[model samples]
Target: MNSDAAISCPPDVLDGSRALRLACETLDIEADALRAMSQRLDGAFSAVVQRILQLSGRVVVMGMGKSGHVGRKVAATLASTGTPAFFVHPAEASHGDLGMVTAGDLVLALSNSGETDELTGVLPAIKRQGIPLVAMTGGLQSTLAKHADWVLDTRVEREACPLNLAPTASTTAQLAMGDALAVALLDARGFGAEDFARSHPGGALGRRLLTHVRDVMRSGKDLPRVQPEASCVDLMREMSAKGLGCSAIVDAAGTLQGIFTDGDLRRCVEAGVDLRARSAADVMHPRPRTIAADMLAVAAARLMEEYGITSVLVVDAQQHLQGVVHIRDLMRAKVI
Candidate 1:
């Protein structure tokens, strides 16, 4: 829908598509504001980055209302990305959280108007602590900007809201800018995906990066295995007993020769084979999916999916059998 149709539509009522288009327009305005901020990033931005780099303590982000919410998210992102940071409500900081701030910590104050009474109220205390302050705001003359050791200019011409009252484009700009800052600091600090995973230990990326196949793969008495010279009937029994739906076929020396799965069993049954007489090698896939025991669980899961299999055999460089990984294991462990 076009802007004219959107405007003519009722205040409280409009078609879903028109509303979605308006929302997209608001996002576009914010995206443009972020672009403007990026273009303005020069030596001043570098100076702010240097100051943050020198901090020995956490980045205490503080703000009110929407800015406070944005500050919380920014702090979380910074923490997970290698910068030690946390959000402290300026009002609450006045009460007791101010103690969390020490002389070594740096402050990132967020205020759209740059004159929030609650945030401004803490300036004296922040000053007394001798902690450096970095201001994110629209007004250069605001109390926050005036006192900031490093001020990041977030000024915007106007908001995307038609009423010019809601914080639409401004908040979006703040979020995008905050992300840029965190990412820059991340790069400067040499924070990699593994470092991020360490910070977000319970999140999916953490599980993927830190979890190994050995942590999730079936081993020892739980592993399913059969010999190449063994009968298919007995191997099927092993698969059923282990509940792995598959069994690795090893040579006399315990080297992986092949893999026998339910799919292989189906093919054997269709081929009219005498299950009791057929050897494991006769029905097994000679080159089955295999991975290293020390490989990441996520990589093992990907190999299984790419091959459309339910289990992967763990082996050494010489194909010595070690263990087995079941698709269900990855699912249960939440590695997939």
Candidate 2:
């Protein structure tokens, strides 16, 4: 069996309060570091954003070690949010990847100490290429900062690590600063949800934005439907054949009259009403919840959840029965 397949209880379940306290303390340290760093944002932050926005090419993010990991995430955030960016390992840049950077591109380097050898090693090439450089570092006087066109200070009061040697608070501060810059640029570019959805076509958000109700609905013969004058037996056959647990009852003009669900059948059975004797209109729910076929599938999902329903009728502009949409269909399409 896969190790991740098994769900394990916390080994220290009895130490819940102790664990909670420690976790909260760690979060507090990182949060406080971000707060202090936010207060320190000034002209340099503005200058950095201005430089990035003016660039027609990608933002080449470079870092070493822990800062490198944070740089990758920052680059991804920038790319997905409209400011094109990608991360290059400082070591790799010193080799051959340095060619990836163009003069039109802007370089954003991250080094908490601002003296990381791997990063400083590639400074000359970046400068020789005349690529505008922006630095994120705690040390303003360090070489990486001195050689850059702009710098964003990410200084933290202390590390959350007990030894103060690990980069807990400092890394958190750097990540927060990166996020701040990305968000600022996002606002500047006027990047909307549709633009983001296009960039992330395979994710859940993409599905929500791109999928429409008509695309996933069962139409024509596949739709579970019955005439308002049809008997309960006919409704049951229609519902069972379609496997939707419900049937839409429409009038002679093909306009929706009501819906008869499994729950309605159960109620009728308890009341001792014979299924063969009654018409679908006599036992159906009038004015049933419905959605337009052109509406977003995710919006239909929200309507179902709000009404505590498992399915809804899809109708045209004039409330004519067009199709049937089930929660299962939305789930299978990954829109739910």
Candidate 3:
């Protein structure tokens, strides 16, 4: 007989079995804790946000072990969302990193027991600097809470671990609460795309937030342009030189009157038009979709998507051709 057939399901996999029993235990404990957290929300959470907002200096987040990991993320979220903040290891603060926290700064400390020795070790120095302490802890009576300027009680019934040792649900709750606080502050500060762009000017979100059509649009040597009076043969030369497969046909005053693309050229050839003698204005599509130079690349994307066009002319309010933005360029940059 095969071992796979011979072996039965583990005791944990059956009804009212080990896994079922433990899952019940975990759910009961965590569910109650989560529910309690909802009821526990009061003035303290507000006070923390208020204090951080009022502070003239940065917010220093500190913790140890798993809490330390959560603290780093909390600090990052806060910093990127308009509030200036950074994480500091509690142990390092006991050494020399304490210098990072200034008298005007606000400190948000994380510890499940509310009595992390490393954190408590630097409390005296923080007190000396007169820095405000906002403690996140499960134990209200813990030393850290007692010494805190504001205490957020995150009391939990038990750990999700079978041995009731490892932090699972507690840390999840802490991270969730931290995110809530950061987003709330972000909203309150009137934080918009531009404010977010400054914090994250290197990624796709940054590009979406900061990049404008003029910044990425093809111009000067790369611009596909021809005079309206130019022959189709001459317009093709401009297209070939720029490799844009299209050229803007501008009037004597430099106002965009039409666009001549490869598609238009193909149609003209199919119609047996005399390409050598026909001027650009006679052959080009009139009134092509145009975008303003100051418009966001994202807005350009919206206009392109709505019009189902591959290219848009970047022009000023006065309709002077500033440059051209192509769908291929936006795609290559992953701006769409």
Give per-residue CA lDDT, model 2, range 1-336, as digits (tens).
Answer: 566655453463478797788789889999998888888889989988988899989999999999999999999999999999999999998889998998799999999999999999999989988999999999999999999999899988788887788999999988888899989999999989988898998998999998999989999899998898898888899999999899999998999999999888889889998878889999999989999988999988998899888899999889899998999999999998
Better of 1 and 2 by TM-score: 1
- Candidate maximizing lDDT: 2
Tens digits of per-residue lDDT, candidate 3, 63-98, equal: 999999999999999999999999999998888999
User: Each prediction's TM-score against the native?
Assistant: 0.87, 0.83, 0.88
RMSD of each: 4.7, 6.7, 4.6
lDDT tens per residue, model 1, 95-156? 99899998778999999889999999999889877888889898889888998888888877
Error of 1 at 311 (Å): 1.4
Model 2 residue 323 CA deviation in Å? 1.1
Root-mean-square deviation of candidate 2:
6.7
lDDT, each prediction: 0.87, 0.91, 0.87
Q: What is the lDDT of candidate 3?
A: 0.87
lDDT for model 1, please. 0.87
Pairs clashing in candidate 2? none
Clashes of each: 0, 0, 0
Worst 10 residues of 2 by lDDT: 4-13
Candidates 1 and 3 compared by TM-score, better number: 3
Sorted by lDDT (best first), the order is 2, 1, 3
